[model samples]
Target chain A: MSRSTPLREVHETLGATLTDFAGWLMPLRYGSESAEHNAVRTAAGLFDLSHMGEIFVTGPQAGEALDHALVGNLSELVPGRARYTMICATGGGVLDDLIVYRLGSEEFLVVANASNYERVAAELTARGEGFQAEVDDRSDQYALIAVQGPRSQEILSSLTDADLAGLKYYAGLPGTVAGVQALIARTGYTGEDGFELFVAAADAVSLWQELAKAGDGYGLRPAGLSARDTLRLEAGMPLYGNELNAGLTPFDAGLGRVVRFDKPGDFVGRAALAPLKDVPPRRRLTGLVARGRRVPRHGYPVVLLTDGTVVGEVTSGAPSQSLGKPIAMAYVDTNLSEGLAVDIRGSHEPVDVVDLPFYRRSK
Target chain B: MSSIPEELSYTKEHEWVAGLDDGLTVTVGITAYAADSLGDVVYVQLPEVGGTIEAGDAVGEVESTKSVSDIYAPVTGEVVEVNQTVVDDPSLVNSDPYGEGWLFRVRIEGTPEDLLTSEEYVTVTSSEA
Candidate 1:
């Protein structure tokens, strides 16, 4: 039997097309993908991200333990703030990328990919057991709802009495939303100004309804995993399985900035990061724009036009929501010169090998 | 909630072929159901104009961020013209698939067999997820 999320009934009522994603039934589209995609860019859209995993680490040594477990520096994170970090293996390979939330000085919440929940939990438990922290898998107890877009604050403010304006990007607050207590974080995968709400599983249905009623005027629509994937891709955000995996490292995935080398304590992969810092990666992930609309897709062999040698492969691609062009992200030889062409199928096209965060919002 | 128009005939592989008054040429494209199944269509590798193809042969391909699907030829024919507009904007296939988003026109060299009629196609689609 297929697993249904808490909001599955709500999605069905809204005429959404459902598909099984990662062993869970997920809505693929609610309305036209173009309209739903535009809604997140121009207005607002809510998403049932209940399938996303949430883990909690609490005890006396939670802070120090987390600092030693992930590559990111977390000592500066005060209560109610979140940090995106990647856990590394002994050889500096990425175990999983996750978001660490500082719920308190001794309490931390880690949100991980759905498919990697148990693996993350197991890793966390094994690593954290040596410390005074207790790692608990809290995914079943909590549900995630993402209300994303430009008018997200305005729509979400009507449901809760908390000060929405004060929640800066990546900052969160433990507050009440739609009469249910939630951890409302101002961070999301979509490249939009939005909020991610974590509420009790039992309260999920009621809150989804209340928010739907309050957000009607803001052109608020319920988006599905389909729009979410395209939105993240257009933003040039990395999906764990697609852009990151056990074979990749934070440095290799263009996430060197998040790695904390100067921190006092020795983390899991601290000894290995020093060597990788100076050496360029074997394959660097970069973006590409195809000629016409024939965009290259994942696993599609991307070759160098000069020698016809297969240099890399496309990892993710889509018609960019922000740029209004077909764009793709690919992993190519790290030493491959800055400027080159990608073999999109048999046809070759020039591509700009540039820095990431391809889509930037107008500040 | 997406509706496949009754005027066009559809293939189980999701391509819809529409007969025209000019000749045996039929305009072909992925149906609305197919477009929805593939999410956002970022690219289309269209069959070259004047190229010949056999029925059930690989004429071209369409790709989204997550899926790559073959654009199967419904009938054996010579590719007459490809839609340049949809080539420049493949999302048109997702927005208005039945109308402005037609893929290409094929000059049919032989008659199509076992092609599902409008009503038959509807029944087939209605039973599908």
Candidate 2:
């Protein structure tokens, strides 16, 4: 049986299409996914992210334990700040990408992908055995809601006096929202100005209702996983299974900047990843825009239009509402730039190599 | 529940067939339930107008935002016409699946394979739902 989040009833009430994703019955969309996508771009959209894993690490060696376990230097992260990092296997392949938030001097929250949270939590425990820190999986205790878009800050400001203006990107603080305690983080995946509120699971329903009531006049629609996927795709963000996998390192996925080798101690994949930092990868993650209407989807081959030689493969793709065309992220041969096409189904559809992000919100 | 027109026949694949009694050509399109399940239709590929197809043959495809499905032929016949409007603007499938979103018309050669009535199609969809 798929576990339902606290907002399942609310989603059902709103006539959402629910699907089993990562062992959780999550809302795929409330109505038209395109409308939901457009709402996030033009106004605001709410998201139920309770399926994400929240693993807490604390103690004197909390930061040190994370530094040795993951790629980034967590010990250097100041309190109330967050950093995107990755956990790699011993062979330097990406295990999972993560966000580490330093809540206090010793408390840190590690947010991980829903599908890999159990494995990630177990790995964090095993990796921190010799250290003085403790790992606790608190995923079931939290429900995360995100308000994203151009009008997100405006809508959220009406609910709480949490110093929304003072909050910087990648920073989080404990505060009260709608009479419930929440960790309001000025961060999101939609490539827009937004906030992600992490609250107790018990308070999820009330907080969602409060936010909905407060956002009624601002055009904040409840978005789902479908819009989230397309929004992140347009923002050039990588999905774990689609982009980063057990076989590809961060460098191969064009996210090597997250791997910090200058940290104090030796990390898990340091020895394997250090040698690969300077060496160029054979296939680099790139973006492709379809010249035709047919969408090039995941696992499709990126081939040369002239000779039909397979050079790379698509990881994630969608009909982008922002670009008004089909866009995809693929790992292409670093030596080749132009004259590319994706073998969509059986036909090779022409594509142009574009920059990573297909859409960027203007500040 | 998605509307199932009482006068139409449906295939187990979620396609609706109309004009079977007219004896010349029958219109085919996916049911509203199928279109709703597909979310937003982005692309529609229809078979050639002059092509011959057997019943149950996968003639073309309907690509949506999240996934794609094959459009199967419901009856053995020659493809007489295809919906150019649907091909141009696939969102019609979601907005009006039975009318403007009609996929194609086939000149029936013989009796179509056993298809469900509106009531029977409701049962099939309800069971799946």
Candidate 3:
């Protein structure tokens, strides 16, 4: 059975279409997903990201513990800052992509994908056995909400006095929002300016309602997973199950920068990934845009247009509302990134190999 | 619940058939319930005009942003005409599923039977919902 988020009643009141995602019944969309996508691009859209996992590591050696457990140099991350990192098996396969926030000198918050949180928490505990830290899975205690787009700052500023303009990207500060305590972080998955609010589960509904009213004039509509997926896709961000999985290394996904081999400690996958830093994999993740209206869906084989040789498979795909065309992320031959066609259903639909991000927000 | 026109005959595949009273040619399209469930229709691949299709055969496909579904033939017949307008503007499948969004016209090959009435289609959709 899928679990419900704390804002389930609120989402129902808004007439959202609910779908089971990562064992949680979350809103798929409030109404038209395209409108929500456009809203985030031109205005702002709200998101309930409570399904994300929050594992806390506290003690004097929390940062060191994370550095040894994951692929990033978490100890170098200063307080009020966050780093996007990955946890990998000793053999170098990724366990999950994570965002580790250094809340304090001894406290670090590791936010993980909902489906891999249990494994991530367990891995942290096992990896930090010798470190002077306590690993706690407090995901249930927190509810995460994000306001993303060009108007996000304006919408968020109305409810909080937390130096929204001064908060650097990927930084967070503990502040009161709409009379409730929250850790407002300038982080987001969508390729837009945004703030992610981490609040107590009980305060979710009230905070959401307040933000809704405050953002009404700013065109902030409650967005769902459908719009979220499209926005992330347009931004070229990878979804956990789609792009980052236990079977693939970060290098395979062309995200080798997130793996910091020069960190002071010997971390998991350090030995395996260190040798692969300069070596290119057999296949590299690339983006594809269909010339026709037929969408390239997940698990569809990408082939060479000339010989029909199966080269790679699409990992994530959708009709891009912004591009006004079908876009997809696929792992194609590292040597050849052009002239690819996705065998959609049975027809080999031609697609062009484009750069990773299909869209970029203006700074 | 989606609207099921009383003048149309329905199939378990969620397609609606009209002009069955003529017993010579009929129009076929996906029901509104199917269109709503599929979200925005991005592409519609209709069977070729004059192509022969058997009842229950997968004739074409409807692609959405999130998913895709096959459009099956409601009755065995030759495809008389295809809606090029819907093929060009797929969103019509969602905005007007039955009228201007009609998928294709088929010349009936035999007596149209084993299809549901509008009331039966409504019952099916409600229960599924």
- Candidate 2 lDDT by residue in tens digits, A1-363: 999999999999999999999999999999999999999999999999999999999999999999999999999999999999999999999999999999998999999999999999999999998999999999999999999999998999998989999999999999999999999999899988999999999999999999998889999999999999999999999999999998999999889999998889999999999999999999988999999999999999999999999999999999999888999999999998899999998899999999989999999
Task: Name the lDDT value of residue A310 in candidate 1.
Answer: 84
Cα error of candidate 2 at position B19, Å: 0.7
User: After superposition, which runs of candidate 2 have C-alpha atoms over 4 Å from their true positions?
Assistant: none
- Cα error, candidate 2, residue B28 (Å): 1.0
Error of 1 at A263 (Å): 2.9
Order the candidates by DockQ, highest first. Answer: 2, 3, 1
lDDT of 1 by residue, A294-315 (tens): 5666777777767777888888
Better TM-score candidate (2, 3): 2
TM-scores for candidates 1 onward, in order: 0.91, 0.99, 0.98
Best by DockQ: 2
Model 3 reaches an interface RMSD of 0.8
Model 3 chain A scores worst on lDDT over the 10 consecutive residues at A331-340
Q: What is the TM-score of chain A in candidate 1?
A: 0.95
Candidates 1 and 3 compared by lDDT, better number:
3
DockQ score of the complex predicted as candidate 2: 0.91
- TM-score leaderboard ranking: 2, 3, 1
